[model samples]
Every structure is written in structure tokens, then in C-alpha cells.
Target: MKLKFTLLTLFLVLISALSFAQKSNNSQSIISGKVNISKYHSREELKNLDKGELLTLYIERIEVIVNILPNIAFATKPGVTMASLGIPETKDNKKALEENKEASDTYFDSTIEFQKSILPYSDKKDLIAAILFYESTLKALHTYEDFKKD
Candidate 1:
């Protein structure tokens, strides 16, 4: 009887595994093909994207900004010069960063209000592209700093 019970459990587990199995097709991915910076960053095509695609971009935008937070610390690091990081001591970059920060804050508050009000998903492609461009700038800055250290 114990052997029979074990066999039954094994069969049930196999059945459950099959039920949970995802499609094996690579082209049918919900988020589409290989995600990268090369993808077109235009807002005019937002409506053309699937719900999954928009959500994925939204998540990516958050991740990119979060990765950039350390750059703020980079500014305060001892012995790290602005020229080394390639962050020019200019009003323009600071102004752009401040604008992005305020936009980020507004986006956060708006997300909460949106959910509460049951609003439809707003396409954030423009904001995502802006943040991505900012992040790329940070990456270039870090790379410059690394090369300068050598």
C-alpha cells in the first residue's frame, strides 16, 4: 500500500508539472525578442506595443534609474574629480538631473493615484527613454573615470 501511495504521488506531481509547463517556442515570448538599447525609443509607437512590452519597459526604466543612484555617491567620493567622471561642472547636466528627479517623484506619486483611481496604463516610453539616455551618460562617465585611473 505504501508503494502504491508513492506511485500515485509521483504521477500527480508529473501531471502538475505538465500543467505548469510553458510553451517551448522562443518566438512566442510575451516580452518579444532580445531586449536592448538598440530598440527604437520613440513615443509615437507606444500604442503599437503589447501590454507585456509596456510593463517590461516600465520595469526596465525603474531598474535603470535605481542603478544610477550610486552616481550621486560618486560625486561625493574623495579623490574623484569631475573631469575624471566626465561629469562636467556645468549648469546644464545638473539642471537635467534635477528635472529627471522631479519627474521621477511625480511618476511615483502618479502611479499610486492611478492605481487608486483605476486609470488605464499610461505609455511611459518618453520618460523611459529619457532615463535610459541619462543612465547611458552615467555609464560613459564611469568608463571615463576607469580609463583615467589607469
Candidate 2:
């Protein structure tokens, strides 16, 4: 029947479109970086702060990154509500975080270099805006993706 043929054609088109999408999505790599959170507070300060203060600090910093996602918001906020739990950082973690953040910076620099390469294009403003927007979006995505781990 014509209806059956039409349905099959539509399904094939959808399958091909999905395959194309996967390829495009996989082409661009993720940016790497980890930020050390200890700089925001000293060991003395973290030790001294009560649960309420630590919770406030966590909320203040993390809120912007995860944005409106309820599931992710839930994972971060509730359990750690108890504070004065002692500092989580060690010398090793600090060194690791520093290295991760450095990698992030390097990735950012590469993106900038890419923009410079395309700067000679006629649409200067649009090109710059697009690249800048991409950078900010990537930064946010990177933070959001690494929320629980870092």
C-alpha cells in the first residue's frame, strides 16, 4: 500500500538523519579542565566555618554552573548540607586540580587561536561573537559536566 511505503520511507530518512547527527556531534572534542576550589577558602577558614557557611559557599558557586537542572541540583545540595566536615583537599588533589585547570586554559587558548585563523573573514562581528559565545558555552558545559567529580 502507499501508506506502508510512505511510512518505510520516513523511517529510513529518520535513521539516516540520526546517523549523520552522530557523526557531526562526535567530530568536535570536549574541552578539558578542572578548577581547584580551595582557593576560595583557606584550610583555617574551611575548618572554622560552620555547616551553614560552607553550604552557603557551595550554593553560591555551584548554582550558576548547573543552572535549572533539578536532578543535578539535587545531587550537589542536599547531602553536603552538614558542614565543618573538614577540608576535602590534600596536596595531591591540589596539584591535580592545578594541572587540570592548566589544561582547560590550554584548550581555551587553542580555541582563541582558531578564531584568529578565521578572523580575516568578512563578517568580523558575527564571527567573533559566534566564537566568543562558543567559548562561554563550552566553559559552562565543562563545569556542568564535571560537577560531582570536581
Candidate 3:
């Protein structure tokens, strides 16, 4: 009788664990679907915008990207460290990593400033090109980040 009870208990625990795993997977899929929907809506909104409006939106989006640069830089840093307790030396290539980060910051800042300056004078084609450039950059960065997570 005790052996049968132990087997039944083990089976129940295994079933519950499997159910929990399935729920976790379902939640992840839901989140991924939401991201896709959001991207689709953004593209639709951009497509419907007039030239002047699109330029304005482009400038605003560039500003937002600039604001998030620090976070992106932090996340993509080559070295790993926990500085709170004063423990360092977690990773190597510090010099090269800092140089690459500085270069990226300079490039992004310059591109943003150039886009802002020329926005008022830009036509539909110019605006569309700028939009595509920024959008693709953002998409690439997001994909890279996701890849890093996995």
C-alpha cells in the first residue's frame, strides 16, 4: 500500500511540473506575439504619415534613441563586473571595448544631429530614406540584443 501511494504521489508531481512548464512557454509566446503586433502597428502608422509629419516623427524617434543610448551601451558592454562590493577584473578587452563604445556613441550622435538639421528641408524621399535607416538600425540592435539573451 505504501509503495502504491508513493508512485501515485510521484506521478502527480511530474504532471504538475509539466503543466507549469507548458504555462511558461505559453506566456512567452504571448509576449512575442505582442511585440510583433506592436511593430506592425508602428509600420502602419509610419506609412500613413505625410512628409512633414513623418519628418517630425523621425526627429522625435531619433531623440528617443539618443536617450536610450546609455542603456544600450551598458547592456552591450564587453566586460562583466560587480562594482558595488568593489570586486573587479571580471572580464578582459576593456580598452578595445571602451574604444568601440566611444566610436558608436560618436557615430550615433553625429547621425542624429545631421538628421535633425536636414529634416526641415527634406522631401518625401529623403524622409522615407531617413525613416528606413533609423528603423533598420533599431531593428538590428533589437535583434542583436535578443540573440545575446539566447
Candidate 4:
């Protein structure tokens, strides 16, 4: 009786442990870096990107906002002055804009914005180092271009 009871208890323990294990999600990949999604933007930031005058106009406006990022990053990396864009100081206003359900469909229609949303949860923690590591990990795992489809 004692032997049978011990064996049953061990089997139940193993089954519970396996049940709690984390499984991989098909939509995302884990690369070798980190990033902080919350620091740069919130979910609301993406929604606030447009005034939503009209569906077509809103899309165009959102596209313009999304398209300028690479250029700004490249330009600033080279130490270009604010005078180039006529702005006195450059700011990283990557905060997620508030979502407006009535304005348009899919606030984060672009891959870049979608990628930003995933950053915060990637590390499972909100520390700066975790975020940086998560950013790199994402880059190593997936391409930015594919983010939209994801």
C-alpha cells in the first residue's frame, strides 16, 4: 500500500509540472536581443497618429507618420541639426497614441507600430536592460518587414 501511494503521488507531481510548462507561440519568434516597448510608446500612441478626417486620408496620414521613422533615425545618427527639419530640438515621442474606435479601422495598421506593441511583453518584465535585450532578441528572431502580417 505504501509503495503504491508513493508512486501515485510522484506521477501526479510530474503531470502537474508538465502541465504548467510554457509552450511556444506560433506567431512570434525569440531572437537574441531585448527592447522596451513601453518607454517609447503605448498602445494609445498608435491610435493617436491620425486625426481620422476620412478613411483614405487617415491611411495616408498614418503612412506618412510611419514612413519618416527610418529617415529620422538615419539623419539624427549622423548628428544632423534640428534646423534641418526646422524643429528646435529632436524628441523621441514614440508613445502609443490613444485609440479612437470611431476614427478608423486598425489603429496599428503598420508593422512598425505592431512591432512596438510586442516589445513590452517580450521580456515579460519592464526593466530597461530587459527591454534592450528584448529588442535585440526580436531583431535576431524576426524581420521588421514581416511584422505587419504578424
Top TM-score prediction, candidate number: 3
TM-score of each: 0.29, 0.29, 0.40, 0.20
Best by lDDT: 3
Question: Over the full model, what C-alpha lDDT does candidate 4 score relative to the true structure?
Answer: 0.36
lDDT at 96 for candidate 3? 46
User: Local error of candidate 3 at 78, Å?
Assistant: 18
Against the reference, the lDDT scores of all candidates come to 0.50, 0.44, 0.55, 0.36
Worst 10 residues of 3 by lDDT: 27-36
What is candidate 3's lDDT per residue for 11-96, written digit by digit as tens? 99999999999655311110100011123125556677887778666765565455344445344222323342243423453344
Ranking by lDDT: 3, 1, 2, 4
Per-residue alpha-carbon lDDT of candidate 4 for residues 54-142, written as tens digits (9 for 90 to 100) = 22222233343333332333231223333444443323321111122112234335443664455434322233333334335433333
Across 7-119, the per-residue lDDT of candidate 2 in tens digits comes to 99999999999999965532111112222132344445555655445444443333332222222342222232111234334556446545654665565567546544654
Output the better candidate (2/3) by lDDT: 3
State model 2's lDDT.
Answer: 0.44
Could you give me the TM-score of model 3 versus the true structure?
Answer: 0.40
Off-target runs (Cα >4 Å) in candidate 1 are 1-40, 75-150
- Between candidates 1 and 3, which one is better according to lDDT? 3
